[model samples]
Target: MSARHFLSLMDCTFQELQSLIRRGIELKDLRNRGVVFEPLKNRVLGMLFEKASTRTRLSFEAGMIQLGGQAIFLSPRDTQLGRGEPIGDAAIVMSRMLDGMMIRTFAHSTLTTFAAHSRVPVINGLSDDLHPCQLLADMQTFVEQRGSIAGKTVAWIGDGNNVCNSYIEAAVQFDFQLRVACPEGFEPNPVFVERAAGRLSIVRDPREAVAGAHLVSTDVWTSMGQEQEADQRLALFHPYQVTRALLDQAAPEVLFMHCLPAHRGEEISLDLLDDPRAVAWDQAENRLHVQKALLEFLIDPAYQHA
Candidate 1:
């Protein structure tokens, strides 16, 4: 049988995605209760990072250890991939010795190329086009805090970057209504917009998007490798900031989330992280639990029956 890769949320059925979220919640509970569950015992994961990260690195590494598995962290300096090695060659060589591989990189094509040659499952930790793993955790956090997000209204305010693209994908898979507010030139990919036609809408005004929204999310105005464009992005994305007043336009119990390492006063209000409406902390922590469940779904034999 061919290995199941998790390069995008589109890779799984809607039922499978929901199951993973539920299982993530259960895993979190088990961990809190002092339960020891190590389904991936003896397995190894190879993590390749072409981009720098904090939460992505720590969550996957820690989750692997908790599952009685080991994870190898490979930076550009640590691998030949940085020294002009083809992704397919690296995938073939690494997959031979690893149970699975997770890559955080720039081009989306790199992941597709790697997965095509990989014998084991290849997970996209992050790519220039999508961040499916983070969506897993975001969904888990929402479910844990506000119940099923099936029919809720989610407002996305900021640059239509990778995370925004994944949220566009998430809206289709998770059955939510998404209202995106971004600058004219910063809108999400037209392909994703057309794919999510009825389920999503794009607007210029943040107030309009947040009005009656159940949950709100945003990411840094400028992501890694885009530092050179920071000043320009700041001026362009200024109107899309998620402030308390903007969030107030949403439902009374509306929640706010950010895929952290946030630029406090930039994409979001400086006080937003500590506000009662912001669940960024829990959302950040869920990265571990959801990823652990993701690892099991892609690796554990028992998960076939689950």
Candidate 2:
């Protein structure tokens, strides 16, 4: 059988995703209780990064260690893939040594090409087209704070970039309603829009999108490799920032989330995270938990829930 890959949120069944969210919480509890559980003992995960990351890098590396496994970090300069080696060729060789791999790259096609030939599972850490891993953490955080996200209204306020695209997928997979507030020129991919099947609505006004929403989220106005477009994006995205006043337009019980490494005054207000409603820190910490469950599911046959 071919290996399963997580290039996007749609890659997994709804039930599996739900299981992961629950299992992640369980893992977090296990860690908190000082219980040592290492189902993936002696296993190894290869992390290939073409982009720099703080949370993604630390979470995956530390999670593997905590799970009684090991993770090897490979920078673009440290790998043959960055030296013009074909992704398929690199993946074929790497998968022989590693139990699974995660790639954080600029192009989504890079993952597709690598996973096509990889014998081990390939996960998307982040791609220019989608960031499924972050969504897993976000969903897990929401479930921990509020119950099931199904049937809830989610407001996405900011650039309609990769994270927004993942939110669109999450809306369909988790059965939530999503309203995206972004500029006209920065809309998410049309293919994702088509896949949403009406789970999403696009609007230009941030307040309009957050109206009565249960969860409000945003990301940086500019992502890695987009520094050239910073000023222009700042000008276009200024109106979409998630402030206390803007979130007030949502339901009184609404929660806020950001993927982390967020710009203070760009995608959100400077003190937005200080509010009890902002769950950004929890979202960041949950990345480790959710990914630990994912690694167990993909690699350890002993994980009964997988």
Candidate 3:
């Protein structure tokens, strides 16, 4: 059988994605109950990062170790691929040695090229076009805190960046309505919007989108490699910030989320993280459990169906 690659949420069937989330919750519960499950014992995962990370690095590395597997972290400065080695050649070499590979890079095409040549499962840690792994954790978080997200409404109140793009895909896989409030020029990729058809609505007013939403999510106005555009983004995105008032506009039980390393006063209010409605920390921690589940599914043959 050909190896599976999780470069986007679209890579997996809805049923498969739901199965993964269920398994992730089980894993989290197991860990909480002091159950020792290490299906990935003796396996190795290689992580290649072209961009710097905190949660992505810590979660994947620690998750592997917790699963009784080892993870090798490779940065551009440490690998030949950083020094002009072709992605295909590097993927071929790395896949021969590792059980699987996860890459956090800038371009989506970089991930596609590497996965094309890889012999083992390839995971997309993050890319300019999508951050599927983060969505896994986010979905898991919502499931844990709010039960099934199906038939619910989710609000996206910031840039139409990678995280927003992934949320668009998540709306389809998880069966939810997505209301996106972004600046005119900052709308999510047109193709993704079209793909989501009846499931998504793009609006200019954050309050309109958040009203009655079950969940509210936003990301930094300026993502990596876009430092030069920070000033411009802030001006355009100021009205879209997920402040306390905005959270109140959502459902009474609405939960707030932000993929972290948050700028305190930018996309979110400085005090929002401390608000009872914001589940950012829980969402952040779920990255470990959900990713552990992902690794088990990809590397442990016996655990693939579990």
Candidate 4:
């Protein structure tokens, strides 16, 4: 049987995604209560990255250990896939040894190509086009604190980068309305907008987008591989930052979120993370929980061997 791949939110049915989010909350509660659940014992996850990571690596590795599974982290220097090997060939070889694989890379095609030739499930850790894994955690955090996101309005401020693109997908999969406020030249991929049908909106003014929003999110003004355009982007995105004042325009119970490694005084106010409405820390921690749910779901029928 062909393995399921999570290259995007569209890969799963809406019901499956919701189940994962709820299961994530249950897993988090179990962990907090000191209950041990290791459904993936002896399973192995191979994580390959062409990009630098802190949260992604830590969360996946720690979650694996906690599940009684093991994860192997491979950097560009540690794998033949980095030194000009074809992604398909690497995936074919790696999938034979690993139960599943997660890849964080530059080109979205790298993930598609890899998954095409692999027997195990291939997950998109981060790609040039989307960051679905992060969205799982973000949605989990929102659901835990504010209940279901269905029919709610979510505002996306600043650069319409990978994380923003994932939000676009999440809006459709999770059944929420999304308003993306970005600079003129920074709009998200048009194909994604088309996929959202009427569920997503793009605007130039952050305030206009955040008006009466239930959830607000933003990412770095400049993402990895875009350092060359940082100054220009900074100038264009300055007015797009998510500030306490800007979020105040949202609903009274609005929740603010950033996919972290936030730039203080840049895409967000330095104190925005400290505000009571900002759930960045909880959002970050949920990465571990949700990803554990994801790992278990994709590699289903996990064993519980010591």
- Candidate 3: global Cα-lDDT? 0.93
Instruction: Say which prediction, candidate 1 or candidate 4, comes out ahead on lDDT.
Output: 1
Runs in model 2 lying further than 4 Å from the true structure = none
Q: Where in model 1 is the C-alpha error above 4 Å?
A: none
> What residue pairs clash in candidate 4, if any at all?
none
TM-score of each: 0.98, 0.98, 0.98, 0.97
RMSD, every candidate, angstroms: 0.9, 0.9, 0.9, 2.2
Show the lowest summed lDDT stretch of 10 residues, model 2. 297-306
Judged by lDDT relative to the true structure, which candidate is superior, 1 or 2?
A: 1
lDDT of 4 by residue, 47-112 (tens): 998999999999999998888899999977977765888888888999999999999999999999
TM-score of 3: 0.98
Q: Please, what are the lDDT tens digits per residue for candidate 2 over residues 18-118? A: 99998999999999999999988999999999999999999999999999999999987987766899888899899999999999999999999999999
Task: Sort all candidates by lDDT, best to worst.
Answer: 1, 3, 2, 4
Report the Cα lDDT for residue 105, model 3. Answer: 96
lDDT for each of the candidates? Answer: 0.93, 0.92, 0.93, 0.92
